[model samples]
Target: MRYDTFLDEVLVKVKTYLAEDGTLASSRDSKSLAKTSDLKLPLEGSDLSSILVDIDDYLQKCVKTNHPNFMNPLWGGLNIAALAGEIIATLTNTSMYTFELAPLASLIERSILERMCEMVGFSNGGGTLTTGGSNGNMLGMLCARSRGEPLSQRRGIDGTKLAVYVSAESHYSVEMSANVLGIGLDNVIKVGCDDDGRMRPDKLVEEIERSIAEGQRPICVIATSGTTVRGAFDPLVELSEICHKNEIWLHVDAAWGGSCLFSIEHAKLMAGVELADSVCWDAHKLMGVPLICSAFLIKDLSLLRKVCSHGDAAHYLFHDETESDDLGRLSLQCGRRNDALKLFFAWRERGDSGWAKMVDGYMELAGHLESLVVEDPQLELMSSRQWTNVCFRFKAEEEEDASELNTEIRERLMQKGNYMISRSNIGEDVILRPVIANPGVTKESLEGLVAEVIAHGEDARRGIPSA
Candidate 1:
């Protein structure tokens, strides 16, 4: 078939799938999936028809993330303009290294980064698009390391005992970044958090002082704007003051909650983000952009360039004319795709108001879900809804094995294919975590998910207990 016909067929399939859904996926079992596709590589090329058939089979087994039933992950639904930009990017197959190779693409990327920096309240800041939010978090630590020990970039650390600090509820990427940056995991300190999951500013100051007295050089403090499981925003305003007073690098990992910047009602969620030296934001999470679009924005453009790259890494690739226009000069990566275009086109189509509207809707939906849990007799709320995530526990009064029972309920949900909400361990309790990230998700669907979960828990308790 022609490429156009093939593309048309894929769109049709997507539309049909979006229109009809019961469970989130047809199958979530490893054994069933293993039989769905041939494992071994074929020696000879297969016909287009056979390959298309194989593609259909693969898609059939995939989780319908665009479906309203999908609430297991922090991303859902689709943005038409972002999908268009993705197709264009694929067709061009261009990298965002230099203007000579991708002039329009590089320009587009620069514009997006500049806009994001400004959104963070920077007057003249700059940044780069990272592979993902995790990589962006890593970039934050790398920059802090470079600034603290400039020689560490070339000669490496000499066991000076550099340290990193973050809230107890921050994303694990901060610790992973510490490991990657040669700051041993042992030196990565976890600060205390209050009941709302926001990092306590006083605890952060105490930790930094404690590290200093111990002769450890505290280089960075990562304040999470939105945590992975709780959808909690750290106390950025208070944390900023502590970091500034102590001369520590403050990086805000706002991957899941950064979309609040677009909403007039929710912008307070990210208040004082401007005080942070750097930030990591993912458009794919709350903005409805496609997957893998994350920004590592820094307050100082020159510092990012100095810390992340040397002036002349590749003479052959970096030409004089492209020097000023090149994006690779400041990026931690090379041969990067034009992922910015996905968010760029999506933002342009909807503009600020449109995106803010979506954010407002999600926030409203989250509140609604929280109320549903509050009214349900069989359910107990684990934590308050801070953003779009509503976490609760399934408890039939006096059930001591509720955690184990809840796990069984989740597994059964996956097996039954009626809903797909995830579960998380908040402290000691295992609670069901449902994030309202899907633009297409409805109030009725969310209510159904709650009812179905309670039903599953009731059923699990009736059977043999899960080990």
Candidate 2:
């Protein structure tokens, strides 16, 4: 087959699949297609026709993340232009390590990073793209550790006990960063959160004082902007003040909620983000770019350059300091894909206002879901959400366990191929967690989701078997 014909066929298949989705994927009884199917590598190479057929077969059982009914994960909504850019990058097969290799790509990445730093209100900001939010968080922690102890990198974080602070409701990546950076999990102190799931600045200050009294140095306080399940933005203004007063670094992990910068009305959610020493923003989340497009932005450019640049001066790849713009030296990743092209093309097409509207639209859908939960007698809102996630549950009889019933209802829904929303445990209650971030989804789709969950829950309470 011709290249154009092959590409057109694949696009048609994906477009058709996305348009008629009741849920992201048809339920397969908890078994994976990869294990069940005859997908094995052989010594012989398959023809183009056979390869295309295999592609179709693989997608048939795969979860359609781009589908409007997909309310499970943080990222949703696919941009055609950005997809085009991904395709173009793949065709070029270029890595974004050196300007000599990817001159245009390196420049585009710099432009995107500069714009993000400006949004973060950094005067002389600098940043590098990371694999994802986890990697970005690690980069922030590494930079903070370096700042706290200048010789720690060359030697080690020995003799001195260092501590890291974050909200109790922050993403687990904070703990992971500590483990990877040798700060140890015991020293990673989790501060308390307020009723709305934001980090309590008072508790943070108290924790820092306690750590200091114990002779443990509090190096950095990590704040969350849109937590994993609750979608809560930490009290950045208050936390920044505390960090500044303590003479410690403040890093805002805005992986999920950083898109607030795109919206003028909602940007106040991240007020005082400028005060943070460093910030991590994921364009792939609310901005709806492709996956793995996260930036670790630093307020001080010199710190980023000093902390990240540690190449042994590879002569062939990096000839001289003149080509300092080569991104590999400033990143943990070498031979990275051109992820910036996806964001750059999408930015050019959407512009700033367009991006803002996209964020507003997702938040509007989330608010609609919240209202639905509030009005329905069967639904109970687990947390007061300020962003895209709505955590709620279907009510059962007084004698029945609501948590168990909710779990049964979700499993039934998945088994019966009805709708797909994740379940999360808030304390003891298993709440239905729906992330309304898909731009193509509508109120009608969400209404159907509520109705189906209720219907399933009612049936399960009466001991009805799942379809």
What are the runs in model 1 whose C-alpha is more than 4 Å off? Answer: 1-5, 464-467
Residue pairs in steric clash, candidate 1? 23-417
Model 1: lowest-lDDT 10 consecutive positions: 15-24
Q: How well does model 2 score by local distance difference test?
A: 0.86
**Per-residue accuracy of model 2 over 1-467 as CA lDDT, tens digit each:** 77788888888877776576544576475456556677689899866677678877767777777766778888887888888888898889988878888999999999999999999999789789898888888889988999999998888885249999988988888889899888988988998888888888889889999999999998989999999889999988888888888889999999999998899889999999999999999988878888978999999877777776665466767767646678877787767999999899999999999989988888888899899999999888999989999999998788999889999988887876656688888778898998976776789889988899888988898888876
For every candidate in turn, the CA RMSD to the true structure comes to: 2.0, 1.7
In candidate 2, which residue ranges exceed 4 Å CA deviation? Answer: 1-5, 18-23, 29-36
Over the stretch 9-116, how does candidate 1's per-residue lDDT look in tens digits? 777876676577644688766886787668778899766567667776767777888888788888988998999899889889987877888889888888999889
| Per-model TM against the reference | 0.96, 0.96
Q: Please report the candidate that would top lDDT against the real structure.
A: 2
